[model samples]
Each structure stands twice: as C-alpha cells, then as structure tokens.
Target: MKLLIIEDEKDLSDSIRQYLALEQYTCEVAYEFESALDKICLNEYACIILDITLPNGSGLEILKELKRQGKEDGVLIVSARNSPDDKIVGLNLGADDYLSKPFHLPELGARVAAIIRRKSFSGQNQIVIDHLTLDIRDKTLKNNEEAVPLTRKEYELLLYFVSNKNRVVTKEAIVTHLWGDDVDMADNYDFIYSHIKNLRRKLAEAGCPEYIKAVYGMGYKFSIPS
Candidate 1:
C-alpha cells in the first residue's frame, strides 16, 4: 500500500520509511506541514501517518482539510502528545488510530495493516478473487488450495492491482505507486514490465485466468471478464 508519513523528526521519519519499505509499502515522507499538504493534495495514498506537532502547523489542521475534501484516506496519529484531549480531538477529526512516540515499528506496522484492512478490505485478513486467495498478513498467495510462489515485487504488483481493480491504471501511476519518490530517478520502466510479466506467468501457470491487461501505451488494468 502507499503511505504518507508526516513527521518532523528526520530520524524517526527515516526509520519509519525504511521499515515500511521493507514491509513492501511505498512510503513518502514529508518533514514539514507545507510539504505534507502538498503531497496530500496531489497524490492518493492508502494511509497516512500524521504527527500532531509539525514544524509549521498542527497536523490536525491537515486532518481537517482532508475531511473537508471528503477524502477517505486512513489516518493514524503518530505524535509525542499522548494527552486524552489530543487523542479525542484527532479521532473526532477523522483519524483512524493513534500511536504515541517511541513506539515499536512492528506495532506501528501492525496498526497500519489493521487500518487498511478495515478501510479497504472489510477487516478481512484474506482477500479472495475467483480461484486465487491472498493472505494479507502472511503475504501468501494461493490458487485452488495450492501455494503459488511470487517474488516480492510480484506480490506487491498483484496487491496493487487487486486494490484498484477495474481502474485504468497508467504506467506512471503504477511506477509511482510501486516506487514512490524513487521512480523519478529510475532509468526506465523496463523493470515494471518485467515484474508484471513474471507475475502474470506465475499466476497463469497456477491455473489462474489472465486478469491483467495492458492498456496499450497507457498501462494496465486488472479485472475479471464479465
């Protein structure tokens, strides 16, 4: 999933970004309020890790703006302020969860997964599509009760496709979603093609139907035939 981390502590933000990246999440960091606002206004994220105390403004203001825009992005407040009032205000302002400072990265990751599950997958740990089943927690994919091994990139690609089923996702969008800000430095999108091809081949070999379709020069779309 794609995540926006709005934090002022550079070390903390870098740690969170690195840990989440290892967990196969595309994470973007903004250390100040304006940068965070700019990102929130421009991109679509599955979840946001917001800090209440930002360098320029309160993260709560950003939350309010998001709510005003009718955005349903999942938000988790990660702040050093552990007061009851702060927690109440954040929750009332549309934050999905709160984690205090000095928290374990694993716990934070778990909270992110839980919020995503509730918001996008109806709180289910397993996502089933036709004969294919994916265990979100364990990061496993199976077809008709048989395990299908997938590379890390392949698994991320499949998850991204499933989450955005039927949408006309562009090559640029896919690259941004998969690599986040790093896509800007990539030489080309040839790696994306290779990952998609490998994923399709594995799924097809596992007896799954071809669900990923190239949109010519645009990108790809994932959907079951009607």
Candidate 2:
C-alpha cells in the first residue's frame, strides 16, 4: 500500500516510515502544511497519517480540503491533543480514525491497516478474485492454495491492479502510485514493463488466467475473463 505521512516531527515521521516500510508499504512524508497540501492534492494514497498541529497551519484545514475535493483516501488523525472535541471535529471532517500522540507504533500500524481495509477492501483482510487469493495482512498471494512468491513491487502492482479492476490505468498513474516522487529520478518506464511482464509470467505459470491486459498505447487494464 501507499501512504502519506503528514507529521511535523521529523523523528516521529521517520520512525513511522521505517516501521511501515517493514510491513511492505511505500511511504512518503511531508513535514509541513504546504507540502502536505501539495501531495494530497496531487496524488492518491491508501491512507494518510495527519497530525492536527503543523508548522504553517492547522491540519484541520487540510482535512477540510480533502473533504472539499471529495477525495476518498482514508485518513487517520494523530494529535497530542486528547480533547474529545478535536477528535469529534476530525472524525466529522472525514477522518476515518483518531490517534492520540504517545501511541504505540504497532497500534498506529494496526489502525492504518484497518483504515485501508475498511475503505479499499470492504473491511476484509483477504481479497479473493477468481482462483487467486491475496492475504492483505501478510502481503502474500496464493493460486489454487499454492503460494505464489512475488517481489515487493510485483505484489504491490497486483494489488493495485485488483483494486482498479476493469479500468484502464495509465503507466504514469502506476508510476506515481508505486514510486511516489521517486519517479522523477527514473529515465523511462522500462522498469514498469518488466514488472508487468514478470507478474504475468508468474500467474500464468501458476495456472491462473491472464487478467492484466495492455491497452495499446494508452495503458493497462486488469479484468477477469467473462
């Protein structure tokens, strides 16, 4: 999954990123309001970890912008403030969950997973599509009860495909979703084509139907055969 961490505390944000990275999530961080606003407005994420306090402005305003844009990215508000009103206001402003600071990292991870699951996977930890089964918690996929080992990027690619099944997704969109701002360093999309090819080969070797389809010059689409 992809996540945006909008926290002012550098140490805390780094810690969160490292911890979540071990769980196989690609993370990007913004330490202030303007940058945070820029990211949220420009890209999509599975969940956003937002702090109510920021260097330039209140994070509540960011929440307002998300609500105004009708963005469906799951949000978990974290603040040192324990006030029920703050929590209430955040929840009312479209945040999916509230976390008081001085919280355990595991708990935060759990909450992030919960928000992603509730929003994207219909609150299920497992995604079953045809003969393929994906275990969200462990980041594993199975074909006909046999384990299908995938590289981290490949697994993420599959999940992204499954999430947007039947819709054509541009290579640019895929790059942004998978690589975040790091795409600026990439010279071309050869790596994306490589990942797609390998993923297709693995699924085919496992006796699964081909789901990912190239849409000529446009992009790629993932769809079950009817």
Candidate 3:
C-alpha cells in the first residue's frame, strides 16, 4: 500500500517510514503543510497519516479540504493531545481513525492496514477475481491453487493494478506511486516497464490469464471482462 506521512517531526516521520517499509508499504513524507498539500493534491494514496499540528496550517484544515473535495483516501489523525473534541471533529470530517503520539509503531501499522482494507476491500483482507486470489494481510498471491512468487515491486505493482482494475493508469501515476517524490529526480520510467514485464511473465508462467493490457500511448490497464 502507499501512504503519505504529513508530520512535522522529521524523526517521527522517518521512524514511521522505516517501520512501515519492513511491512512492504511505499511511504512518502512531508514535514510541512504546503508540501503535504502539494502531495495530497497531486497523487492518490491508500492512507494518509496526518498530524493535527503543522508548521504553516492546522492539520484539521487539511482534513476539511479533503472532505470538501470528496476525496475517499483513508486518513489516520496523529495528535499528541488526548482531546475528545479533536477526535470528534476529525471523525466528523471523515478521518477514519485517530492516534495519539507516543504510540506503538506496530499498532499504527495495523491501523493503516485496517483502514486500507476497510476502504479498498470492503473490510475484507483478501481480494478474489477470476482465478486469482490476493491475500493482502499475508502478502500472498495465488493463481487458482498454485502460488505466484513475486518480488516486492512486482507484488506492489499487481496490487496497484488491481486497485484500479479496468482503468487506464498512466505511466506517471505508476512511477509516482512506486517511487514517490523520487520520480522528479529520476530520468525515465524504464524500470516500471521492467517490473510490469516480469510480473506478466511470472503470472503467465503460473498459468494465469493475461489481464494486464497496455493502452497505446497512454499507459496500462488491468481489466477483466464480465
């Protein structure tokens, strides 16, 4: 899953990123409100870890903007205060969950996972389509009864494709989702082509159907006809 950490504390953000990286999540960080807003407006995310206090603006304002835009991205509010009003307001503004500072990293990770599941999978941990079964909690993909071995990037690619099934996903979207802000510095997205190629090869070798389609001059689409 992809997450955006909108936190002012660099140390806390880094720690969160490091911990979540072990869980195979793609993380991007923004320690200020403007940067966070830039990212929020530009890209899509599975979940956003938003701090109530920011240097330039209140994170509550960010939550309000999200609601105003009718964005469906799951949000987990992180605040040091234990104020009930804050929690109530955040929840009222469509924040999925609230977390106090000095929290356990594992618990935070679990909450993020749960929110992603709730929003994307209708509270289910696994997604089944056609002959393929994807266990999000276990990070496993199976073609019928046979398991498909995929690298971390390949697995993430597949999940991204599944999340936007039947839609033409642009190369820029793929690069930003996989590499985060680093795509600005990178020259080309050839690596994405490689990942897609490898994932397709592995899935086909495992006898799965050809579901990923490349849209001419646009990008790629992962679709299955009814």
Top candidate by TM-score: 2
RMSD after CA superposition, every candidate: 1.6, 1.0, 1.2
Q: Model 1 residue 167 lDDT?
A: 87
TM-score of 2: 0.97
Query: TM-scores of all models?
Result: 0.93, 0.97, 0.96
Kindly indicate the candidate among 1 and 2 with the higher lDDT.
Answer: 2
Off by over 4 Å in 2: none
TM-score of 1: 0.93
- Give the per-residue lDDT digits (tens) of candidate 1, residues 4-108: 999999999999999998888889999999999999988778899999999979999999999988999999999998899999999999999999988999999
Ranking 2 against 3 by TM-score, winner: 2
Best by the lDDT measure: 2
lDDT of each: 0.91, 0.94, 0.91
lDDT of 3 by residue, 1-226 (tens): 7899999999999999999989999899999999988888887899999999999998998888888788999999999979999999999999999999889999999999999999988899889887789999999999887888999989999999988889999999998888786678878888899999999998888777898999999999998787
Q: Regarding TM-score, does 1 or 3 come out ahead? A: 3
Which rank order by lDDT, best down to worst?
Answer: 2, 3, 1
Worst 10 residues of 3 by lDDT: 178-187
